[model samples]
Target chain A: MMTYDALSFLLKAVIRFGLYMLLCISIYMLSASLRKKSPVLIVPTFLSVLISGSMFVLYDARGQKSGLDHRAAVRWLCEKPILFTILLFAAAAVLLTYVTFREAHLRRTVPDRSSIKESIDHLPTGLCFYAENGRVMLVNHRMNQLCHIILGRDLQNAALVWDDLCGGSIQPDIMRLSTDSQPRFRLSDGTVWSFSRTQLPDMFQITAVDITQLHNLAQELEQKNIALEELYQRLKVYETDVEVLTRTRERLETKIGIHSELGQTLLATRSYLLDNNENKTIPVEAWKRSIALLRQNIVENAEQFTLQTLIQTATAFGISVEVTGQMPEQKDVEKLFLEAATEALTNAVRHADAKKLHISLTETADTYRICFQNDGKMPETQVTEGGGLGSLRRKAETAGGSMQIDCHPEYSLTISMPKGGTENI
Target chain B: MTRVLIVEDAPMDRQLLELYVKQSGQYELVPSVESAAFAEFCCRTTRVDLILMDVCTSLYANGIDAAEKIKQNFPQIKIIIITGQPECSFIERARKAGVDSFWYKTETAESILHVMERTMAGETVYPESTPPLQFGYITSDELTARELEVLREVVAGESDAAIAEKLYMSLRTVKGHIQSMRDKTGFRNRTELAVRARDCGLIIVDKETE
Candidate 1:
């Protein structure tokens, strides 16, 4: 039992100190507006102020019933206003802090804006927005560094007058955007980008990317492929040329062989014909023209007309025939008549079962006539396909003569050579 | 001795006959002329035992024509038709002309000259393989001797142009000769003429080859 007032004052000091400490704690907890505090803190701060005020009010209402000197307590509590102010300040501070934090949560976040940046410092790629005409606008730091190192100029928003980065000006055709497939540009830095139409067809997006090493590899590969293609085409051309040359050589060889054989035969014929001294040889050219003429005649006559030699040859066979009329003044009329008659005789014997055959020849002033009549009648036949007679007719026409045949007549035969021929006998 | 007259158009043929006649001393070679006209003149002027008539002769005269004419004038003279090849089926023509024989130039030899002498003395000599034994038909101047010669040339396989040149005549003349031959023989064409000549043995030929 120390002094009574001292004990009471000591008790008041302890409670006041506890309340100030608690208010300080509340201020400290509510002041953290950025952090989410426990829900317990809201009620506790409100109750602390409410309870302290209510206690002061209750004591005043009870008067003497409080069993203490209420007047003095009430008057003391009212005169200080410190405890109420402290509780109000603590509650206001906490409530203001909670509202501030709730508003902050709904609004945009705030950062330490002291060092805000407009864009990335060093872009991931060598990205630069160039104009469709290869004009550089703004670029990232990586592009900036590349431009400085490659072009050696700040070139702020510079229309790319040159393409030093790619070692040369890229063909502007890439920038010609079209709806179809576009051209792709691979920079030396391996940055690959395709030129595409922008919002406007006239404009394009020529973006760069860090494909330096890739571009180099692709360019090297393209060069090697081009060289290989050129070599392949050259080889193909060479092969064709070689084949042509081989064919030419073969044709020349064949011609040479034919010429040599022809020359030898011609030489032999010439030597035989010109051998007045028996053993002397003659040049082939001497008879070559005659042989050529004969050959031409033979081919032409054989193809178009019946040849006289074939008739002559027929005469060599056995055939019976009788001839009459005056002996003409033909130098070889006798031989010709005999040959023709012999051929007629051969045909009659081989083809016709004739009893007898009559032959006659006559010569007028300008016309000559020849005929052979057999006992057997001619056969009635149509013109056959690929007829020998047709071919013979062709041959006869070649000798300036016309031929006709009457298959079923009493005098069925072929009469050749027109009537208007001079008899130079 | 059998006096024989040889009428041949070719000099070579006359020479060959004369050479064969030389081997037969019994036969006297009077002369080997080239034409029937000359042979006829000789026959009329001289007394010949036998006349050798060639089947063909020059353009002006023919041996067969000459033989027929001589037989008409000289009734006692014997004519023998001689030819390189039988050119026609001359049936009974010799009998009508009073010809004693028909001889082939290929078959007749030096011994044939003696045979002719015996023939002139009334001995019948004929070829071993002869087929012209017609029972007695007349072959009109079926073919003139010269015409026969021309026909033979045709059978020899010479072209009209070539033959005309060989005979020293133009092609037209040769064609005329051929036309006349065809007319007389009743042949439609040369092939028929040659075949007939071969079938009748008017000329020797390789039938298969032709």
Candidate 2:
């Protein structure tokens, strides 16, 4: 009887534990359904709660009726074994279905480990995180592909890959973006990428961003700048042409005016000459004016003022210019020499009434010297700097040269200029 | 006989044209004037059959402008625009002005009387081209348009830097043009090049100074 009583207590304890497990599972399902707002879990939770509550109530009534005798409850369960076995089988089936549905729901909603890795692998840019020991922590597919191209292997050590990129020992297919300190490279397909690194708390992160479009735009802009420069040059040439045409028109107008004046004067002379009346005179003033105009036109139309022209003019004035030694090959020096000779010719003719003018040219290592001496009378008084001499002196000084006039012991003028020093003039 | 009116600023050219009209014997000479301003009035008062107009007339009257007005008013009166200056846009302006014939005083090989006769004979007479002038070792026609532009600035006494700035070219480019011109002309220096160019009347600058 004691053994029966012990067995009854054990069975009661086993039943209570099973009921407690059912109650806990039901409550958990209820709370989980409420949180997720899942109507599918509601039926399963209600069934579990009802079964556990009814069983608990039946056991308690049997225990109270028998006055703490566990043997009566044992005998009660033994008599309805078939009914208890059916109920137990039904509860086990319900629990199995609920557990299976819950597992499927979790699989559909939650991301798996492989899926998370797939997302990181498909990123556009190259990304890698590495530890201090050069161990690759997290590397994407793009980075591994870049490593294969650069290092000829999959990414094992990200720090080594970064070192290879920075060392600039890559293949000819890769070109450096610029001479700047930034690490940027251009691939063979015209794709430009800029690589950069950042230090995290315990790791290092390296990234390569695509910059092809910006590089192409910069190249296009450079080409346009060159074209604009060419267009600006063309416009400038047109402007200068217009300016020249305008000036030419003005000169033609002046010439036409002079020609018209001369024609009018000729006509006046003809009319005066053909006049049959004795009241008309010769019009001497008009004739003189016409002659003056003709002379002015002739002088204006004379050859340009060069050394040859100057010499011809001096000869026309009954003064012969005797040039000795070779003239300097430099244009500016030759021009200055001719100017001084002209001044000497004018001074000799106007002031001293000379006939022969001699010009001597000589060159030293660094200076060109020209001396103008005329066979004219000596100056009666000390010669001062007048308009012509003063102007010549100013010009000479401006050209980085010097001019001197010696009045005594025959009149001679010497001017010296340094070679290659008169370019601005 | 065609009655003609002469409009010329210069008395010599006007007298010459008057003599040509009188000597033609086929044309009758009307009154002559010194300016194109009197051309329309002369046409209005007289029975004018044709008009000989000069491009640059006295009183600042442009003959082309006057000719355009006359053509609009009396299109029947045949007009011939004559000019001595080759640098001016007289030919183009005269054509746009609807003048009957154009004659260059110095450049045209044909006589002005021939041009007038052609116009009276219902022929549109125009020269093939302007007369080519000798400039240094090359003719004016031989110079490229760009080279001519640079030459004009050089003749204007502009420095290389100034010319480069004005023409929107580099300093080296201006120097290059000058050097090319020198090589073509075989001139010794820039001063000689400028002086010879001016003397040849290829490029005329303002003031006409040395």
Alpha-carbon runs more than 4 Å astray in model 1: A1-425, B128-210
Superposed model 2: Cα runs more than 4 Å off: A1-116, A179-181, A260-425, B1-210
Candidate 2: tens digits of C-alpha lDDT, residues B79-137: 98887655323566688989999887653212777888899898888777555666668
TM-score of every candidate relative to the true structure: 0.25, 0.34
For candidate 2, write residues A1-425 as lDDT tens digits. Answer: 13212347667667666766766766676676666655566666667677776665555555455654356554565356545634763684486467548847875887677876887889999889999878998889888877676556677877777877777477667777653434788887778888888999999998977889987898899999999899768755854575455345544654575566567667766877787557766656445544544544232221334566556645643568888788888877776676566567667766776778888889999989988887878888888887557867876788899989887677778888888886534
Which 10 residues in a row give candidate 1 chain A its minimum summed lDDT?
A: A297-306
> Which lDDT values do the candidates have, in the order given?
0.51, 0.70
Q: What is the TM-score of candidate 2? A: 0.34
Residue pairs clashing in model 2 are none
lDDT of 1 by residue, B1-210 (tens): 678888765544455456556544567877565545455445543568788777545433446656777777676777777765443533245555566677765542444565577668776554543344121131324556555555656766667877787777788877887787777666887656654554445553322122
